[model samples]
Target chain A: MSLLKEFKVLAFLVVLVTGAVLVYAIGDFPDWGDPISPASEHVSSYYIENAIHDTAVPNIVTALLADYRGFDTMFETVVVFVAGIAVLFMLRRPKRESEVSMDVSGSPIVKTATRIMVPMMQLFALYIVAHGHHSPGGGFQGGVILGASLILMAIAFGLPSALKKISNKATVMLSALGVLIFSGIGILCMFLGGNFLDYSVLSAILPGTDRVMARSHAMLGVEIGVALTVMTAMFSIYADLASEGQLDQGL
Target chain B: MIWQFDIIILTLVIVSALSALRIRDLLGSAIIFGVYSFLMCLLWAGMGAVDVAFTEATVGAGISTVLILATVLHTKRRTKD
Candidate 1:
């Protein structure tokens, strides 16, 4: 059989199997938006109600990220930093005797479309990170989106252009800065006679009702930091892989 | 009817997994793996696991597929084993 025919057959079979599983599994599932589903009952509810009052953020996810489980966020940021460092270390080469220009040869249409999409993607990522305080998404999701935007730029324009926008040095610096900012918030809390990341004490430092807003603002700040670190780390890894043609060509 | 839908999705998952391992071309396998992830996301949604589905859609279908494709670009398309 032709490869295309085989592929089609395989695809059809896969679809059929997946449909079967869906039917069996969904029989036990609660109705969508039933609020009393296992997920809502298990954990998200506690965070949803108390998170707003305690953290002063309308977005439950953001509060969970920066306050309820701030320690996890810290470590998550560190993971990104480590991944960036690892990629840079592996891809590091002695200064080329002559700098090899990694230019892309692509159609004008593709290039134009990428140029249009890149900025829009970047904006969308920023929106996700910023609005995380009011919505379902938070740092990690937004960070991935941001990384994807850069990856798109690399595929369309060329690694060189993408590298110009996001250098290894810049990524490292930004990643470290993200960690620093996150830790700094913790330090600020400590200074206010609270444990690490104890945001309630932040109110003491601020004047009045502003305290709640300040704490929420602080949480948002950390979310941005996390987003920056993760996005860059993932982008760097993708860039390294693509630069070497790991997907299409031989390693 | 919904039960029928679930059964169909389950069948797709099984077949995709088997084909992913069976494919000779690494690129083709990676693409199929991506489709598998998408199917899994839909299944999760059907099972009322919206958060899991959302995560799967974004991380699995979105970033992971791209990352895998990048790795495929660096490596040979055909698997020798």
Candidate 2:
């Protein structure tokens, strides 16, 4: 172990040299707020200018993210789902070994605080998810908040209370459902004679709505699916890691 | 010339990060790192990148801190580093 101590200094020096090199190399890049930079002159301008017209979503980030580049977002959800599964596979104890003090809440005061705070957090998360078309938030941010609420419940009232509310089986199912909803929508669009995730073609299934309005509605649905997957993934990861796979005792 | 927010917040970030590095207790370092994350979130929000800031706030200050603290609780508290 002492031999490893000698390498710490070498590691620090390497990091310092790398930082200096990065600072020097950054001179080649354009300065902050440079108008003529490649990014500013590229597709971002098109996205900014045409996103609202094409998608009928006021939020450009939302439009570009959940609509124009929905395939990327769908895969990102899969990555989070994989992370949850990874934690479960790596640490979750066998069912027989998971029989410990699973229902012991932390303390009365903590429980009281969590009881009051959880609902508000959930409500706010819903607002963030629903209002994403007009605001800075979207599925990922809201889903994190929603998941945090469940994690808070676990911390305050023990893992059993949290798990009882939404069992591990449910989360596993839901994580898949979220990704399924996304890809399913894309597949449906394809079946309707449009490209994958081209929500404009979804008007056939929904009447009294034009193509733009259909796209707007479809974006919201995709965002909701994303939120569901993200929230469940976070919840599952927390449970698996905190309880060391037992799902019984956790902080 | 009112760089007051940036200067103060950046100073806080640097100070918190340094303290986190210096702290012998793993839990204390984790909490201080949370403070650093929060300050970095504020800096990102100030720069008008609200989405990035939101992610930083939720992931860095919120979930990662909690997860790391749980990891510390599972392991030893004190550190030679």
Candidate 3:
């Protein structure tokens, strides 16, 4: 059978099975917005009520990302760093006297669309990161958006051009800086009289009502670090793949 | 309405996983696996586990798929039976 025919069959099968399963599973699922699941009972409720007062951010997701479950965020940052290193190690090539550059020219419409969308996407990412304490989005979602914008750049102008704009060295450095900055905040907290990552200790250094603001500011700082590292790591991986012409080469 | 979404997502997950296994082409399998991850994300969201869903969408659907596709590109497109 031709590949097109095979794909059609696969699509039909997927739809049929999916429809059947949906009918079965819908009967068993909990009501949305119940506020009684493990999420509400275990950790989310606490974050919802106190996070704003404690962290001074309205976004529960942001509080979770930076404070309530910050240890996970730290490890996640490490994971991204490891991934970036792994990709670099796998794809690094010796510079030739003359390396071939791929043609990156695109139609006027595509170029204009990318140019308009890139900054808008980036701003949206920042908004998500900043408002995470009050809304559905946080560092991870925002970071992914940022990475996707970079991927869009690669798609529009080609890999080499994207790489030229955000070099591998720069991305690696940004990843390291993110980790270092995060750990540094913890260390600073330790110095001020709390355990590893106690944001409350930061209050002592500030005056009057500024203490609450200080803690929130500190959390935002760490969230930014997480976002930066994750975004760059993702972009680095895409760069590795594109450099190898992996998607197009069909191996 | 929410339960309906959950069921839809769960069904999507199962279908994608099964199709991924059945596909003859390695690239197609990788793409299906990505779709599976995405469905899993929706399932998590429907269950009100937004954080888990967010992580799954990013790591599972986004990065993992890209990595697998990259590996496939560097290797074979079909598995020998």
Candidate 4:
């Protein structure tokens, strides 16, 4: 047998065994939403009970993510930023002379529709970020939607036009700025006599609000940072990948 | 979660996932992967994890699919054994 065929056979056997083991493991999992499950019986209960009072955010998930676990979120943003930079480093290349020319315009119907939808999509993304403390959507989801809108614009009106709007330089800078914003907030909290990412201490510097409100405000700021990083990172990956790192063509 | 809806979505998720792996056309596989993502999103939503559902929808179903399709277009459309 060929080497490739042998390799495929081995891979398939491994996959089949792994799948069977996983299926067997699934039978031992706790029933759906079992309150006594280890996951629901410990820190989760504490978060659900006190998240709102502690962070003044109605969305417990947001509070848990942005305030209680701000350190993790900050690193997550950094990871996204790094991923964007990695793609740029690996794939980006100067435009080729022969590859410069292509059809740049799309059907008017699609262009017009995208034109109308893009702004609305952006606005909704903002809403998702801003209202995340009260709702289901948050920085990550909003950022992806925003990035998808940009990708859609690229698809409809062509890459060059989209690049004109959000240039590679801007994407890189914006993504870095996002990580900066996140860490910057943490640093500010430390400067205010608290641990890193401890927003309760921020109340000492702000004019009127108490510690709870401070945490709520800080969560929003962190969410914005996350949104910015995620959106730019998503767009950068797409632009780089779609254009084969040339940033001068579209598929 | 409703058992009926859960079972239906879980079935579709498995079907799409298996087909996505089996499909020889790279673009078709990518699109089927998106379908798998969407179904997973539905399952998350049904389980009341709206934030996860939203992320799965936007990142998994939307962006990853388009990215894969773009890559497929630039490369080979069909997989060779």
Q: What local distance difference test score does each model get?
A: 0.78, 0.89, 0.77, 0.91
In model 2, where do residues sit more than 4 Å from their true spots? A1-7, A95-103
Instruction: Report the C-alpha lDDT of model 4 over A1-251, residue by residue, as the tens digit.
Output: 69989999999999999999999999989998899998899899999889988988999989988989989989988998999899889999887876446866689999999999999999999999999999988889899899999999999988999989998899889999989999999999888889999999999987898999999999999899999999999999999898899887777
lDDT of 3 by residue, A1-251 (tens): 69989999999999999999998999876666667855568767777778777778776666767886777878888887797788778876655445555475567898799999999989998987887766677777788889988887776787667777887679889978888888888888899988787777787875664656767777877878888888988887777765562322111
Q: Which of the two, 2 or 4, has more TM-score? A: 4
Alpha-carbon deviation at A51 in model 2, angstroms: 0.9
Best of the two (3, 4) by DockQ: 4
Angstrom error at residue A130, model 2: 1.0
TM-score of chain B of 2: 0.95
Ranking by DockQ: 4, 2, 3, 1
lDDT of 3 at A201: 79
Per-residue accuracy of model 1 over A1-251 as CA lDDT, tens digit each: 59989999999999999999998998899886678888889788788667777767876656776887898989988987897788777875554445455456467998899888888988988887888778666677788888888787777776766777777678778878878888888899899898998777777776664656767877877888888888888887786676652222111
**DockQ score for model 1, please?**
0.31
Position A141, candidate 3: lDDT? 77
- Candidate that scores best on DockQ: 4
How far off is each candidate at the interface, as Cα RMSD in Å? 2.8, 0.9, 2.5, 0.8
Candidate 4 versus truth, CA RMSD in Å, comes to: 1.6
Q: Output the lDDT of residue A155, model 3.
A: 69
Decreasing lDDT order of the candidates: 4, 2, 1, 3
Candidates' TM-scores? 0.79, 0.94, 0.77, 0.96
